[model samples]
Target: MNEPLAERVRPKTLEDYISQHHLVGSKGSLTHQIKKGIIPSLILWGPPGTGKTTLANIIAEESKRPFYVLSAINSGVKDIREVIDKAKQSGGLFTSKNPILFIDEIHRFSKSQQDSLLGAVEKGWVTLIGATTENPSFEVIPALLSRCQVYILNAFDKSDLEALLKRAISKDKWLQSKKIVLKETEALLRLSGGDGRKLLNIFELVINSEASDAVIITDQLVLDKVQKNTVLYDKTGEQHYDIVSAFIKSIRGSDPNAAVYWLARMIEGGEDVKFIARRMLIAASEDIGLANPTALVIANSTFQSVSTIGYPEARIILSQCAIYLATSPKSNASYMAIGKAQQKVKETGDLSVPLPLRNALTKLMKDLGYGKDYQYAHDFTNNFVASEYLPEELSGTSFYVPGNNQRENALKTFLKNRWKEKYDF
Candidate 1:
C-alpha cells in the first residue's frame, strides 16, 4: 500500500488491536457493549497515538454499525451535520443499533460546534465516539460531556510497545520480505514515548533508510536515523514528555528562570494552554502542597483564565503561574502521606473498623457496641479528645512527615500538641 505503514497496519478487529485490555479484554466494560451491539456515546481520553481512532473503527465493525468519520481539526458544524444526515439516512434514529459518528480530536471543536451535536446525540441520531488527547472535562462542554461515558486510554506500557514491534515484523508482508533482527530497542521505545503509531513510523523510517534488505536494528542505528529527521518539539511524542518533565522539574527545583524558559518552549511550540496549566496545577499540589496552598489557587485560576482566553494571551497566564509555583515554598508532605497510607492499606487489607469509629444508626448496631464507647469530641474539653481513629492494629502509625517549611512546621507543632507524642510528628 502507498499509505504509511502505520495506516497500512491499522487494526481491523479488536483481536488485532493492542493495549487497553481493561476496556477490550474478556471482562472489559466495553466488551459486552460491543458484543451485544448496545454501543453508547463515549469519549475516549488519552495521550497521543493511543489508538483512539483505531478502537472507534473496531467498535463500529464489531458491532456491525455504519461508521462515519470527522476530523475536529478541520470539520465544522456543517461537516458534523453532513455526517449525521448520512448516518440518520443509513439507519433509523433511536433504534437499537445506531450509526457511529467518530470525531477525532473532539477537543478542538468550538462551543457552538459542540452544541450542534447535542440534539442528534440526545435524540440518538448517532452514537458519538469522541476522541481527545486533552481532558474531556476541561475541553468538552458540560452538557455534552454529561451525556457521554468517558473511557481513559493509558500510554502503552513497555510490553505493549514490544508486542507492537513483534506484531509488525511477524504480520506485515513488506517487513517479512526483509531479514530484520531487533538487536536492541531502547532508542526506538524511548523516542516513540509510548505512542504506538510513532514507534511504527520510526521503525519503518529506519528500515527504509537501510540500503540492504537485511536489517539488524540496534539502539545506535535507531537513534542515528531518528535524530536526522526528528523535530526539536514533538508535541505528542518523547519530546513532549521530556520538555514537560524539564518544565515541572525546574519548578520543583525552584528555578523560576528555567521554568519560564521551558514554559516558553512549550507555548512557542503550540502546546495546549490547558495542558501546560494542568501540569502546573499538579505541581502546585504534588510539589508545593502545605508549603504554599495558595499556589494551587493561583494555578487553578490560571487554568480557568487560559481556558477562557486562549493563545497569545494564555501564554502570559501560564508563565505567571509557572513563575509563582517555582518561587513558592516546596513540600511533598501531603503527597507522601497519602502514598504511605495507601501502601499501608495494601499491606493490611480490609482491617475491621474499631467499634467506636462505626456509626450507630440502628438499635441493633448500638447493641453490637457500635459507637457505644465513642466519646464526642465536641463534648470534651477544648473540643479535643485523645481517641484512636485508625484501626486498632495501627494505633500509632505515622504517615505524614512534615516538610521543613514554615507552614508545615506550624502544622507539625499542632499535630504534636494534639497527639502528645502518639505519632512521631
Candidate 2:
C-alpha cells in the first residue's frame, strides 16, 4: 500500500517542520541544546498533529543519535525492555550520543509500564521523547515526569495550515502535476480543527475525487466531501464541546433524564471517562454549591474512581455522579463568590493585607503590630467575634452574599446573629 500523504510529507528535519518555532528557531531552547549535541529526555504535550513526532525525529537526526520508537497503545513493559536493550546496543559505549527513544501517545501508558522506563531513562541508556495529547501531569507517572522536561506544542494556526497545503502542492510529486486552487478554507480549517495531518488527508481526498486535472477547492466542496466522511462524534472535535456543554447544562437545569442521556452519549462515543467526571466535578461545585455540599465530594470520588477503573465500569460511576449532581439542589453562590472576589481584587489591585490578619512569624512582623490586636474568635462568645478582616480599602465590601436557600439561609441567620448586620444578612 502507498504511504499516506501525512507520512509522505512528514518533516524529516527542523528546517522542513512548520510551526513550533519557539522550540526549533534560532535562540530556541531545543535549537541551542541540539547545536551543543546535548538533548534531554522530554515529553511533548499538545493537541493532535502538532509535529511532536516530527520534532522528535528532527532532534534525533540533528543530534546524530540512534532513534527508536514505541507506541503506548500497543507497547507493554516487555516492549519497553526490548527497545531499551536495543538502545543499549546502539549506544555502544558512546555516552554523548545516547539513542533517542520516541514513544507516541505516551499518556496511554499505565503506571507499571511507565515505571519500567524509569531505570533506562535514569541511567541515560536512551534519551526518551514522549508525545501526548493529554496533560502529562495527570497521565504520566510522577517519577518519570520529574525525570523528563515537558515541552508544550500548540495547534497549527490558519497560516500554518495554509502553508502545509501550499507546500503539498508545490513539493509533492503527485500534487505538483495537477492545478489546484484554494478558493476558500473556512470549511477545511473548521473541519481539521488544527490537526495538520487530518487537513492534508482531507485535502488529498477532495483533490483525488475530482475527475479533471484542474481543481478548485471551495468551502462547499470541502463541506460536501467532509460531511459524508465525518464521524458522528469526535472526542477532539466540535461534537465533543457541544456534547459536554449539553451535559453540564442538563445537570444545571435539574434534568436528570437529560443529564443521563448526554452521559450515555459521551460513554458510547468513547469519551474519556476522566474528562466526563472532571466536568461533572466542576458542575457539582459551580451548580450545586452550598445547597448540596456533598455533591462536590461525590463528584471528586467519581473522578478518582473512574480514573482508576477506566472504561465500561467507569461509565457506571460517571452516570451515578451525573444523576446525583442533576438531582441535587442547585446554587451558584460559591462560584459567584469567587467571581466577585476576583473582580474586587482587579479593582483594588494589590491592596495591603490588614495588619491584624497578617502573620507574625518573624520579630519584624510582630513589631509592626501584625497579630497585635487580632481578635481571637475562638476565645470570644459563640466562638465568634466581629472583626475587620479585609484590607482597609475593602472594608464593608461583601463578596459572599449567601444565596436564598435552606442551607445558606441558616448561614445568613448565624452571620446576622454574630456580625450584627455587618454582612447585611
Candidate 3:
C-alpha cells in the first residue's frame, strides 16, 4: 500500500530520529532522564519538520508508557476530558506509569481547552507532551508551562538533511525498489528548506514522474516540477525563512533595491507584517548601531505604527523602514564590541568590584575604603575625571570602539580630548 511519505518514513525511536542531537544525544539531559525511566511533562518548542511529534512518540515508546495523541486543531474540552478519564481509569494518581498525552500544535488550543488538561497533568493522570511552533511563553499558560519542561529543537543542518535523504533512499521499501540516481541535491534541499518531510515529498514527486529505469534528478528538473506545482508561499514553511533571510541580508548589504524586493516577496506571500518589522528593529541596533543612532528609533516607531494600522497600509510603513535602513550608513562596531567584552568576561572569571567604585551604604563598607578614593567627576574639570573605574585586574580594559560614522567620529574626538592618556583615538 502507498502511504503518505511522511507517515511511511516517520521515526519510531530516538536512535532513528535525525537532528536534535542536543535532546537525544548521549550526553543530552532529556535522553539521560528518559533512559532512567524518569519522564517529565515537556513542551517541545521548535519550527515545523524538526521532529517534535516524532520525538514525543519516541519518548512514549522508550518509556514503555501508554501514549494518547490529540490535535489541538480538532480536539475540544470534551475530547480532553475523555482522554483524561481514560488515563485515570488505566492508572492511579500515585502510580509512576501515567499515559503520555501528546498534543500537536498545542498553541492552537484556546485557554479553556488548555485548562481542561491542567487537572489531568497535575493529578498525574497524564504526562503532557505538547508541541508548539510558537513561543510557549506567549502561547502556553504560565500554570501549564511551569509543570512542563520546555526543550528547544533547532532546525536541521545541511548534514542532518543529507542523512535523512540517504536514509530514505536506502531504507524505504518503495524507494529501494526504484532505480534512483541523485545527480545533485541543491534544489531538493532548497525546496525542502530544512524540512525532512517536505524533502521526502519532493523526492517522491520526482521519482514517481521518471519513466527510465535509472532515473536521474537534477536541479533544473526539480525546479521545473516544483514551479509547475505553483510553489505557494507557506507562511509557516520554506518561504518564511527564505524571505526573512533575503530581507535581513539586503539591509546588511545596504541595498535598498534588494531590501524592497525581498520585502515585496514577503508581503505578497502574506507573511506576518509585524515579524518583518521586528527583524528591522533588530537590524537597526545590530547592523546600523552608532553609525545612525536614529535608525533604531525610526524602526521602533515603524513597528508601532504598523501594528496599530495593519496590512494593506502597514506595507507602506514597512517599506519606509526597510529602505531607510538599507540606505543608512552601517556599522556593527557596537555589536562586535559587546561580543568581544562578553567573551573576555567568560575567559576571565568575575573580578571583584574596585573599592572606590563600590557602594558605601554601610559603616563596614565605608571602613573598607568603599568610595573613599573615588574622584567625583562632577567636581572635576569639564565634569570629567581621569579615574579608574574597572577592577585592579582590569584597570584600563577598553570595550566600546567608536565606528567610522559621523556621530561616532565626533564622539571619538570629544573622548580623546577629555582623557588624553586613557582614551586613544
Q: Write candidate 3's Cα lDDT for 46-105 as tens digits.
A: 988889999998888898888999999899999999988888887737546788999999
Ranking by TM-score: 2, 3, 1
Each prediction's TM-score against the native?
A: 0.80, 0.85, 0.83
Instruction: Compute the lDDT of residue 404 as modeled in candidate 1.
Output: 100
User: Which candidate number maximizes TM-score?
Assistant: 2
lDDT at position 115, candidate 1:
98
lDDT per residue (tens digit) for residues 366-405 in model 1: 9999997888999987898999899989999999999999
Which sections of candidate 2 miss by over 4 Å?
Answer: 25-29, 92-96, 255-257, 307-313, 336-376, 387-399, 421-425
TM-score of 1: 0.80
Ordered from best to worst lDDT, the candidate numbers read 1, 2, 3
lDDT of each: 0.92, 0.88, 0.87
Which 10 consecutive residues of model 2 have the lowest summed lDDT? 87-96
Q: Model 1 segments beyond 4 Å from truth?
A: 334-402, 411-425
- State the displacement of the C-alpha of residue 59, model 1, in Å, after optimal TM-score superposition: 1.1
Evaluate residue 288 in candidate 1 and report its C-alpha lDDT on the 0 to 100 scale: 99
Candidate 2 lDDT (Cα, 0 to 1): 0.88
Better of 1 and 3 by TM-score: 3
